[model samples]
Target: MSFKGEHHPGVQTPTAESAGFRFNHTMLRVKDPETSLAFYTRVFGMVVLRRLDFEEMQFSLYFLARLGEGDAVPDETGERTVWTFSQTGLLELTHNWSTEDQPDFAYHDGNAEPQGFGHICFSVPDLEAAEAWFDENGVEFVKRSDQGKMKDVAFVKDVDGYWIEVVQADRMA
Candidate 1:
């Protein structure tokens, strides 16, 4: 299948060197790790696959993923680290020390002027149920499924104001 619009000249078929390449994770800098972690884990039901701390650098990295049924995390640290890196659709939250203590500290959410990075998305089984769950959890909504012209897509904001797009893929079809 081809796209409707004119294609880029630089676009080419995948090469053997890129055969095994996969999107690993997208990193977002957060002001507070605890708040961001709680929102991601408790609200989104994502599991913390691995965490790394650079004491000398005064920063920490938290890797999270939504695992499927019967998926098991490795008991060994090295194995778990390897396993964490191998998974797709992971979210990495980076926290620099002492940022949380500063009341004025903020991260650019890329929704304002000169917008660039937009949002991360999650596909749900039921859009209505997910919207209800987000409402119950007191999540800040950017747009609801029934609110906009786009009927089946919703957007919610995290603790640090990063947008998360929610959609029911089956309904979209």
Candidate 2:
């Protein structure tokens, strides 16, 4: 089947053909799996929905998701892979084992001089409570909600220096 498409300059509407798509997962390359996993699971309450380790490739992939209340993660790989692909919001952490020994190694956080990728954001119910929890757990904040001119918006850095924006779901501008 062949179809032709035309571009409408001023049209700002979605066509029916594009309505069925859903945003899947975002992947972040992490230097250390232990610290990154701990920061995400412990701080954000995300669970490892699936994990794929390539021993020969010297790397591993960890799929994490914040499963809703009463939702259970499947123990079997077949069921888990299906479940992982069915969700819209998911975080994938890729761990390169070789980075474990490189203490001074770092990833481009995107907020540097030549910024390209911005950051990943999480919407929480309560901004204040989340901020306090992050502070208590020693999570480094790139921009606190109350610091900048933009209120109720904050950014925190992960173990790999990747920025993760934290905002109140009901209070976002």
Candidate 3:
């Protein structure tokens, strides 16, 4: 298959929109993988697929699957892109090389001002289960009620101060 005179295996002829293109996981760098991994797995209901190490590179990458993205298989061999699929979406935790010269990176803080990048939003089918997970993991939130669009929506933050919005969309009333 070819696209624009280039060999594109999946896409024979790419248009403005392609079926192969879809919204996948979001990436976040964490200073402490242990803490961040736990927070995401426990609070937001993520699962770790595997952990790879680059000893010479001096960093580790943790692959986590989002909510119902469990057991997703990817059929690609890429250097930077760890391929995975999810019922909802995918997640990739990239641990960069840390050395004497490597400067530290910063993750987002829950929208205290809403000026920078806004929080990443997700959808939870069972609102009660989502609420319970938050409470159990000690996630703090500022609650509000807005039902004009969907069901009730809530906000919460992870351990590293990254904001997350979980939408509770039930059937129409």
Candidate 4:
């Protein structure tokens, strides 16, 4: 199917003033939840805000975020679901049940030949410090902050081989 949209140089799409919008979350399929969860929590200090299991569907969704200090997650599922929707900067990891038994299972990281998806990014307060911590923690590095042509950015791979771009907030223009 062919899709087409034309953009006039100075034209802007209109939306109702009452409409509210926000970029909610991006989901990535992971082979192993334990390893993937551990990597995000341990390396980035993200908390598992909510987890929804679909036994019949044979898949699970885990939502994680780096909440503000002293922020608490709601105990009740309904309240938690509301809280989850209200917050921003969420990372959702979807795990398929069958992948657990297949030790050799792997997912297309989107960076290969048929590249459709790129990489997810995280902004750090101190790029050097984060890079140091990553090195100390033995995390795999795809492109170190100093090695590539883009000297200000760094890329690292999670357990599932998904590339995450790490950038410094202050250094960004």
Candidate 5:
């Protein structure tokens, strides 16, 4: 996506930094998996991929991705649902259930306010389209700034109050 920082057009894209290592998956801790699942599914348009349920502990596990036909569903289990999809990239959603054998623990500490996790980011084919969406949704954003020339940083918060950073940097290249 086209990213314009407070200063100028952001550097290159993130993929350029890593040799081949792309972003993998991001996990969040939810008070209720069902409620959280709903947020990702209904709001963000993600589908469940894999999930485990522990009826004994009253907990469930869920995995979700952006919806796309190219994606494949995993083997089914009685415990929970399996969902997968793709946008420009991938979005994975997980729901974990706790049983007598396992107790619940927070996966991440949302301490940085929105800046902590920042936010789970996805790629967009059109930066202007993305900006328009943000504008229509009343999403707030920080303009980008340049430390030198090849590095830029800015912040935006997600619905959950976690910071999502918009970054653009060109390795010494």
Candidate 6:
């Protein structure tokens, strides 16, 4: 079952009609907006690109991104919304009302029994420094970089117990 060559025989190349298609973002449901926001911003240095509140739906969609240098973020609401959707690798956190108040409430992290969604990954410039920073911030590690059989790779759990895989690209090379 080695997919060394073409994985899908039917589609040798991308469809011409889908040339403009781009991966927008990955959405994850959070129990508490405040806690989740803090974890993403502090740990990953992501900025809130846009936040849409659906009062009728009783949920809020927060779009966050790790903006690079000279990345322009429109201040206007409509423009910001457009910019947020145009970017790739964005993280969207959906917070439902009253879920934060429920002390026993928790989202299945997709790593347990009957697992579906696995985890999101973050490639860091410096693995050692990032691991130290995670330690300083009291991040819970599922597997340290040097702990398991896999070297130069780590997995840490967020406040919501979501596994975030950390890796250094250069190390893999």
Candidate achieving the largest TM-score = 6
C-alpha TM-scores of all predictions: 0.93, 0.87, 0.62, 0.89, 0.47, 0.93
Q: Which runs in model 6 stand beyond 4 Å of their true positions?
A: 1-11
Per-residue CA lDDT of model 4 for 1-173, tens digit only, reads 55335678976665687367776789999998998999999999998888999999999999999888787889999999889988877999999998967978999999998998889999999999999999998889999889968998999999999999999978878
lDDT (10s digit) by residue, model 6, range 70-125: 99999999999998899999999999999999999999999998899989999999
**Candidate 3 lDDT score relative to the true structure:** 0.64
Show the colliding residue pairs in model 3. none
Task: For residues 1-173, write the lDDT of model 1, one tens digit per residue.
Answer: 66545568886777789888889999999999999999999888998888999999999999999999988889899999998888888999999999999999999999987898999999998889999999999999999998979888999999999999999998888
Scored against the true structure, residue 86 in model 3 reaches a CA lDDT of: 29
Off by over 4 Å in 3: 1-19, 55-57, 67-88, 97-106, 110-114, 144-151, 171-173
Clashing pairs in 4: none
The lowest-lDDT stretch of 10 consecutive residues in candidate 2 is: 1-10
TM-score of 4: 0.89
Which one wins by TM-score: 1 or 4?
1
lDDT of 3 by residue, 107-143 (tens): 5563555566667777788766777777766777755
Question: Pairing residues by index, what is the TM-score of model 6?
Answer: 0.93
lDDT, candidate 5, 1-173, per-residue tens = 76544554766554656776644456655655655566566544677666656677655655567656875555655322422322234444344444222455444535544535446554444444555555666655654334335244444544444445544333122
Off by over 4 Å in 5: 1-24, 32-35, 74-119, 138-155, 165-173
- Residue-pair clashes per prediction, in order, are 0, 0, 0, 0, 24, 0
* TM-score for candidate 3: 0.62
Which lDDT values do the candidates have, in the order given? 0.92, 0.89, 0.64, 0.91, 0.50, 0.94
Q: The CA-based lDDT of model 4 is what?
A: 0.91
lDDT of 1: 0.92
